[model samples]
Target: MSAREEVLARLRAALAGAPPVVPAPGPVPRRQGDRPPGRPELVELLRQRLVDYRAEVHRAAGADVAGTVAAILAAAGARTLVVPAGLPADWRPGTVEVVVDEDLPAARLAGLDAVLTAAAVAVAETGTIVLDAGADQGRRALSLLPDLHVCVVRPAQVVGIVPEALDRLTPGRPLTWISGPSATSDIELSRVEGVHGPRRLHVVLTDG
Candidate 1:
């Protein structure tokens, strides 16, 4: 017999009476929804599911986005904010104790009130905000250290599904996927939010 046949004969001798392998079952397709999910329908479904996660979402168009971001920070009572090095000047909030990414020391981050950033893409289907540390988005540390985070995302940047979001993100670079606030459930079944990351997450969607 050939070497391959010899190997197979030895294996069969070791467990000659064993049953053939059986494949495991997978999740069944649900009939929960009446219709299939198209891109437009997926976006809407994503929006609704994100709301179910208790995320606050805002929308604005064109030049109004700047003013909207400023208002969001103001309403949240945020004073110190980490701004990206390459963020658009017009997107900045006026008169907030702005701290640039480079200027922020790692040790003092716990005291920071909030962080303002942009996203690589917003996956509506999963209610996820993706970060690739690009010009618009800042270092991953800035998002992690602060208690509250405000993300500015353009409507055109919103994709219908996770695969589409993956295409926009960088391969080896730092990627942060945030879905709602940082939360965990206790053994007693009580839920607590914001333990490891930001306590609150607010997303501002600008359409231009």
Candidate 2:
């Protein structure tokens, strides 16, 4: 037989004894009561996990968010800041120049010192924060290009695990899952930070 015919016959023979394929079942919806841990516990877990992941964590009450944000920026020595159009005006400090306009070029964004925004949900177990391109969160580029990112996460937005966080997210939106500052290791295992994203990640956990 020809080479092509031989190959086809062998493939058919291998599949001939296989059982019929079955479609996988779809995901079942979880009940509302399929809850995570209590708010305080989850928040604490998230704080620990994020710290372990090498991210800076801070706690604040809703009324104190502005002051906390200001302190973080000042400590980082950020001269210029950017925020999404829908970001709460009070979240920014009056000391630095704030830019809230849209359609900023990548070059311009890369020149900024830091970007600040809120998160959609955070996974405590995984130390991850999900940004679903929400108004406060802005576009993915806003979070990626900057050298520093300060994300404000409310206690109520913390989930126990990844699946729980995924269930809360809308799949259609652009989702950015951040665990820590971007880092990659070379073949020799020398770690280099900020290869792809922010070099520094700061999480401000606020109670609303």
Which candidate number would show the highest lDDT if scored against the true structure?
2
* lDDT (10s digit) by residue, model 1, range 11-108: 99877877658655578664333333234455565567666676677776667766877787788888887778988877777758877788578767
lDDT of 2 by residue, 1-208 (tens): 9999999999999889886577666887754334554388888989999988789999988888778878988998998988999898888878788988497999999999999999999988889999999999999899888899999998889888777887789999999999989988875897666777999999999877
After superposition, candidate 1 runs with Cα above 4 Å error: 1-44, 189-191
> CA lDDT, every prediction?
0.76, 0.87
How many clashing residue pairs, candidate 2? 0
Give model 1's TM-score versus the native structure. 0.76
Instruction: Choose the strongest candidate by TM-score.
Output: 2
Q: Which consecutive 10 residues in model 2 have the weakest lDDT in total?
A: 29-38
lDDT of 2 at 147: 94
TM-score, per-candidate, Cα-based: 0.76, 0.83
